[model samples]
Target chain A: MSAERYNRQIILKGFGEEAQQQLLRAKVLVIGAGGLGCPALQYLAAAGIGHIGLVDDDTISLSNLHRQILFTTADIGKLKVEVAAKRLQEMNTQIGIIRHPIRLQKNNILDILSRYDYILDGTDNFESRYLINDACALLNKPLIFAAVSGFEGQLAVFNTPDHLTPSTNYRDLFPIPPDKGEVANCAENGVLGVLPGILGTMAAAETIKLIAKIGQPLTNKILSYNLLTQEQYTIKISHGGGYTLPKTVDEFLNMDYQDTSEGPQGYAEIDASELVKLQQLESTILIDVRERHEVPILDKQIFTQVPMSEFGAFMSKEFYQKHVVLICQHGIRSVAAAEAMQEKYGDAKKIYSLKGGIVKWRDHFLKP
Target chain B: MKIELISFGKISEFINNQNIEVDGIADTDTFKQYLENQFPALKSMKYKLALNKNIVQENTEITNNAIIAIMPPFSGG
Candidate 1:
């Protein structure tokens, strides 16, 4: 690397040749090449991090261009990892950019993650987040976590250095995943174009700080920032003292993240189109679990009104003869209702929860 | 004792109010039970409770006149 290219950060008070050397030797693996990864990768590359890995299998769609700043209009159909790598390489020829153009699944995460000195999570789902956290903990690698939704963003440093006072991981923050449909994705809820940019840049700053050993990193704590109100909150996370994390790769491989004994909970769930198919059968019954007062009420004649609170009282063996579908305000409650019904009735009934409930139905079947 | 409760992100949308004052809530666990009972819609959503700017594990006690916050995972990025 040229001296002129790195002089600005090197001349800073405490950071000089020693920190610059550390940054040049540090290796980071960033998962997800969408909104958050773009800005993080750009900054890390520009900061002259010696080796960086980019992982994402998604293609750049036109919708992503508004928030994903790495690519232009012409790069829409390209793979995110490839495009990001090329751009990062062009930005800093001194840094090494490795592209993994595949999804981060349990099968390959261990091998790929072990190679990096640090991991930065820009993933968009809970499953991936948890998986990455476990892998990082098992490997004793520090992770920089960032997430954005709507007008808000959150950043945290998890599984920090052993020398730190006390360290915490993601599970300590969110004990479990939110039930499906309980939380909406950016696709469903929408987000401010700049939210991820701000958060991702913060993520990059944390990474640079971790490598360069500059200021205090956000380890053992979480910082939530809301762009709308311009408010920020930081909360300390205490070590839950140590618990059993997946110790071996095989244990992680055999891990069943879906559901318990009765098998995958999602198996008993059906999408909107499937509900339409089952509706044609005479034995199929659609039960609306939403309260009567809820808006855009379903037609009373076509569906039975059995609010979830009263769902237990209406159960019977005869319901087993038909394909019973539970519907609620959104898909989440219906699944909960279906699980309760399944517990009471066992497998005798062909019970199904409407995947998105009336909200999806209204969007697809009813609303103009 | 009175405590102020705050919620953020989608959890805030479900909660509606940015801040609320409550009395007679004993600890973090009781406060959570109160929240779930009051807003049945929150039963399924995942969230963390922070008492006075500290994230507490389940059943941790809440001191009087503290600020409690409800936060869910912001998984958008």
Candidate 2:
């Protein structure tokens, strides 16, 4: 292949031959093989980026075919990274493609991410978004970040400082995540099909700007788009007062998500397994606070019947006489109920929630 | 007291055309209060309040000549 493909872009005075070669020598890792990732990966591969890393744990579900442009209908139910690399390889084998089939976790993110020069975030979940930001902040790597929901999308560059630019990061814009449930994914509220396409293309443009060093980048300002009306707006952002270089990725990782949980807070008490044994000696009452229709059914007659919704306003503190154990499916609602009881009853009745719920107890405690 | 209040993004569009005066403009605190009064939505959104390019949080003392910029997070691409 000749340099003719990039010749037009390279001839521009600022990004001439040197920047084109930089593009040929750079490696980029993209997380999330969903809607955003597909478009971002497509343009980067077409632009002759040097090496690309595709990390995703999801399989190509039939529902994703609408926006994840890389896969075919037949590719549904197949591993995303594997098939994505194959398609990308078929497009341009000259660009080295490494597919990591594992989910991005705190333990493996550092070792795996250390290899790439630039990162593009396409993740849809907060846990993964935090991991990406923490890893990038710790590694001092330039990140082209983008997120989309409904008819809106945001694009920005984090930690990329050039000769004339000052350092800026995600926290400079949003010091913390919104309360959980404030922003719902497209799955719940619905999104225009073309939203991610516009955002991902801008993300690709930003990546080239960061590498080419030619155009103005969205460093301290965030560009917001409403594709429904073809409207565009931008907001200027500056560093927050408490912003500082994070000591370790762990320090950044430990930054608590700013109250994004918008649902009702139900608390339950999960207790040590031995407490149930001692309670048996003390004749403790056990309450099953789950609805009768959840998975992992238990056969113990020690259980009491009480659905979470009805548990309150129906059963009084008199129901739980001394120490009581609360159980539920996955331990979410039941523990919440136990905490409510603890608040009402206080030290008069000791309430403990079984951790990991009944399934955990069956596996760890009651195994034959 | 008189002060200029400007809101950007979605919030800006809502208040862009009206030439309105807010009563009880005792201080800058009242300026934000006036905004919250006009658009009930302002109370729900977390905004970066700026006084002539200086970032200010809630409870910031208002100067009579301050030009306040109310900016909200634009999460669109």
Candidate 3:
């Protein structure tokens, strides 16, 4: 290791040559190359975390430039993992940057996560959050978790025991994943560019503290930051119950993390053609969940007008249909309705949401 | 009793960031029940309650003038 490169951090009290060496020896895996991942990776790389593995299957788009600082405008359409790895390598030539350009799934997450001593979760979705939390818990690896939505951001360290407190995982806070469309993500709610930047950097800071064994890491504690108010608070996370955590590898693999809220278990998202096929079946019921005033209206004879405004009332009424197909303008509301239906009828009725909604399949709906 | 109710993320949508006065509620369980009853939307949302910065593992007593924070899990990057 070049002593001159890390002189600033090494010269600081409590963090010296030994602490810098510890950072060089640590293996950290950061999942997600978007907002949080980008900033965290930048600092982790510059700090010379010896072996860093980045996991992401996302391709950079024009929309990602505001906060995803690693990618340039010209680098748009390139794989995020590839671009991030290249930029991080340029930032620090001494550290080894391993790029795993793959989406983490139940089958692949364990093998990849097990290789690293520390795991950083910067993934955006609930599915990945719960999956990584459970996998890290099962693998006995310390996890640095960070998330940002709208004006607020959250940071926590999971699966790492603190003095007098046994460790706490994500599930200890939220036992079950919210319905897929029930809670809005960064894409849906929108986030301030600087929000994730702050949270991600703090995630890196916590990781560094944990690695260097210096300051107290946020183990079993969650910190919430509000960008709008510039107010921040940290809360202790106690061991929570009422949630099932897969204890064994076999149990972990068998657990349905993929279809947690929607998909095979809850509801299926289908296309226009599939809708037509299901239309022929007498048991199928097509419900338009769009607000009454919106859209080139569907045929009243076919679609039962159940505006989402009064969906709560609609849900209470009994329906005879075995297959329920929900449609809306952009298909977003339909998925929400489908989720509600799925929760109400479980496996008794098959619920489906039109993938692109009526707007995408305008010709099919407008046909005489 | 009066308590400062601080909410973060989506939980703020249901309960505004302010000081709320409660009369009948005595513990975290009853306080949560009252809050959810008042803000019906909160019943569907999952969040953790912290009293005076310490997360409540179970139904704990709510002391007067205690600072209570409600935080929901954020799934964003």
Candidate 4:
């Protein structure tokens, strides 16, 4: 460890050589490299954390540049872990930066988390957060949790390994994950560029405090902040029920943290190219389920316009022997339409939905 | 008694105004019922309620001029 690099933090009243050494020996794993993970990784690296892990399967895109500060425009299309680990290493050569350019699934979470002393959840969804919480709880590893949306953010430290007293986990705060599309994320709803920076740094601060024993960490309490009004506060969170987390690796593997798409079962999903192949057949039919006003309309006259609102009306009067393909703005509503048609038409007609709808069709086949 | 209701994040979209003044509400439970009745959309949202900046899990009595904060879980980074 270079004494000159971390001299500023070393000079703080009680945070001296011993605390610096503690940081030098600690191992922390950050789950995502986008938004919050970028700033937390940077600050942790600058503070001389000895070992850090970066985990993300996503690649850098133009949209992520506003908040994911570690990546530059030139790094677009590169894996996030690859880009983040390189940047972190350039900043602090003494630290060990492990790059796991893969999504954290049930099969690998324990193997990855067992190697680290602490885990930082920078994932942008409830599924990953809940999975991390359960795995950390079972492993007795402390987790630093943080999330940001729009102008507000939340932070908490959970599973601190203090068994004598009760501690709260994410499940205690939220017993179950919200329904799909119930909570809007930064992608659907806009987020202020600087909000994640502010919250991610706070998460890093908590991690350092826990590692170095510097200050009171935000354990068993959640801190909420709103950047729009600059109002911030912390509230105590308690376990509501006597809920037990998965004890064995097998149990954890069986847990379903993500909300699976509840589209109709046994439905065929055809890609744009596959649809084109099927279009050559004389009996193939395409039904546009989107509203008539929707843009990027299909120029092919063979496509019948049957908006979802009037799907029931169209089904009542028309009976066709042709192979049917349903399409909407996105594949979600189209899947539902396919399910409804299957219930009415049964196996009499072969049905399919365009896998990603017209937007994907345009991207793959129409774009020049 | 009158209490000031403040909502945050996506829950604010369901409420007509960010801050609402409710009269004749004596407890958090009734206030929650009133909110659900007024904004049916809020019934589906996952959130926690804070009274005077303190998170109260049980139905606590609402005092005069108290501030109740309605906060929804934010799953973004």
Candidate 5:
């Protein structure tokens, strides 16, 4: 390792060459290269972490520029892990940056997490948070957790033993995941650019402290910060009962970490052309989930209006169609409708949502 | 008996982020029910209650003037 690159941290009173060496030998994997992951990865790489693995399946979009500082405007449409790895590598060439451009599923999570000594969870959804937490607990890996919503953020270190307790995972706090749509994410509730920045940086700090054996890390404790009031508080977490944690690998695999907020779990999102093609098939039904007063109307003969306001009543009636396609104005509500249909039909019928919604396919709907 | 209540994250939307004077709630279980009735929105939300900065795993007695924090899990990155 180059002493010249890390001279500042090496010369610190508590952090000497020995601590720097610990950082150099550390292997940390960060999930989700969005707001929290971006900042955490940057600082972790800059601190001269020897090996860093980044996992993300999303592509950079224009809307992510404000908080996801790793990507540039020109880098839009590029894969997030690709761009983030490139930028982090540029920040510190001495360290190794590994990019896993894939989403974390139950099957793939264990294999990927086993390679890293420490796991940092910066994912944006409940599905990933619970999955990573369980895997880290099962593998006995120290986890640095960070999340943000609106003007507030949370930071915690999990699965690492402290003086008073064995260890505490996220489930110690919230035993079970909330129902779908009960809680809103950053996309639904907007956040300031600096909220995740502060939380992500703190997550990196906790990781570094854990690696270097510096001052006490946030083990068995969770910190909450409010940007609006500039006030923060830390609460002690204890082992909570009433939650079932998978004990074995088979149990973990069998556990369902449902994707609650993103979209319909077990359905397909098709485009306008695919919708047209399905119209030719027998026993195919197209549903418009928009409100009665909204937007351009489609042909009544082909389209069936089932407004979301009265969807509960519509769901009680049985339909014999084999293929059910749901559509909305912006594609957001259609996903919600698809989720409901998936819950009702299960594997008995095929469910699909119109990608980009009717607004994007106005011409196709308006024609004829 | 009175208790001080604080909220964070999405739970803050339902409960104001200040010390609230709660009365007649002897335990965490009853306090939770009281909160749900007071703010009907809290019924659907999931959160953890910390009494005096310690997360309560089970129903614990609420002392007078004890600080209670309601924290909701944030899914955003």
Candidate 6:
């Protein structure tokens, strides 16, 4: 009968038939199918989650195959949604899937998310993470989030609708963004083959735990996993950090939503390029907050490259050390890097990520 | 000490031949004020500012030692 479908999971003391059935009936939406989303979607669909929504707006890149396991070599150049949907459909034909092939923008997210009960965030950068958090916050939906950097991975859930437990978001975790050149990303810093595998599996675990109402959710806790040592630790987020979450999607998208506890002015930032050549020479440390693997790194001898993930472990001093210039694959990680460093460093100036990142640099200085 | 500015990628026409400076503005003035005095068009350009190398808001005070750089909000992924 149906008992055989979930025989193993149902054997758990607390997660018996009822929990399995709960998972079978739950509707979960997994946004992003890259590194983190790949594994998260696999387990949920395999577990026969009643209805699943797979959303993404990307194509298969030769670069993605290292961690994105859903696609094969022949699947290259195909739409991610098309390929991912095909794979999920095969995983569990009995389950329902609502495929969204478009990028997860604020406009389309609400309607798509209104019907789902649980949301999983496997996105890499901060913009999507913030948009997802704000949208779910206002909608009062339960969200499971997981992000990994080098050896570190973080997981949490935000349920703003729950009156008793106001959720903590990425903003709450790192109140201010890091300056440019303060952090690194998997794209630039080489991620071990199993890093995303380890993290994505954790995300899948959290999704099911939330759906099945199991023993405990990573709801109020921030779980950090270090693959280098196989050590996992959890930090409880405190409330009331004076950060006012954005009220509307526009507010979130306007790029004005800032976390500024670290800067002398907090999240307030300036363009590093505006400082004239003489100014840069006078008093500033132009640190590049990108991973070393990013090709054609910035050429200025004045600039230093420090990956964002490792920034937390370094920088034991105050913020605004030497007018840092953070950069990354694009600008998303740099913004997150800025906020993370800003929140942690807590005060100084001369820290700004390149507005468009090194790609802009490549186009400007070295472009053909 | 004066704050100098430069840009890459796509350059706006306003960038050329403009030697803009605001007098009586110390390094301690917030970058937003610097924009108000130097590039009036940039005031509404919706750009972000930074000293040394970090992004800063409009009201941040200018510091003599700060290396101010003005740029736009990040949109690329």
Tens digits of lDDT, candidate 3, A1-368 = 99999999999999999999999999999999889999999999999899999998767766689999998989865789999998899899999999999878899999999889999999877888999999999999999999987799999999999887898999999999886445753124677788899999999999999999999899888999888888889998899888999999999999888732243225777777789999999999999999889879888999999999999998898989999999998677887788788778888998889866776677889998
iRMS of each prediction: 1.5, 4.2, 0.9, 1.4, 0.7, 10.9
RMSD of 5: 5.8
- TM-scores for the candidates: 0.75, 0.66, 0.79, 0.76, 0.81, 0.57
Best by TM-score: 5
Instruction: Give lDDT per model, in order.
Output: 0.80, 0.68, 0.87, 0.81, 0.87, 0.63
Candidate 5: docking tier = medium
Fnat values, candidates in order = 0.86, 0.17, 0.86, 0.70, 0.97, 0.00
lDDT of residue A275 for candidate 1 = 82
Task: Tell me the tens digit of each residue's lDDT in model 5 across A1-368.
Answer: 89999999999999999999999999999999989999999999999999999999777766689999999999976789999998998889999999999878889999999999999999987788999999998899999999888899999999999989989999999989776557772134788988999999999999999999999899999999999889989999999998898888999999998632343146666767778888998989999999999879777788899999999999999888999999988677887898788778877888888866876676787776
lDDT of 5: 0.87
**Model 6 agreement with the true structure over A80-187: per-residue lDDT tens digits:** 878988898887777888888876665677888888999988876555666777778767788888776555576777663233456766555444444443333223
Q: Model 6, residue A143: displacement in angstroms?
A: 1.5
lDDT of 4 by residue, A1-368 (tens): 78889899889888998999999999999999989999999999999999999998777766689999999989976788998999999999999999998878788899999999999999887778888899998898999999987788999999873434377788777767676546762124577778999999999999999999877898888888889789877877766653568989888888986532222233466767678887888888888898889877775586788999999999988755568889876566787798787667766777788865765556754554
TM-score of chain A of each: 0.70, 0.68, 0.74, 0.74, 0.78, 0.67
Clashing pairs in 4: none
Off by over 4 Å in 6: A160-165, A179-182, A185-187, A248-368, B1-77
> Which sections of candidate 4 miss by over 4 Å?
A161-165, A185-187, A242-244, A259-368, B16-24
**Candidate 4 local lDDT, residue A363:** 72
Q: Sort by TM-score, best first.
A: 5, 3, 4, 1, 2, 6
Candidate 4's DockQ is: 0.56
Sequence-dependent TM-score of model 4: 0.76
CAPRI classification of candidate 4: medium
Look at candidate 5 and tell me the lDDT of residue A32. 90
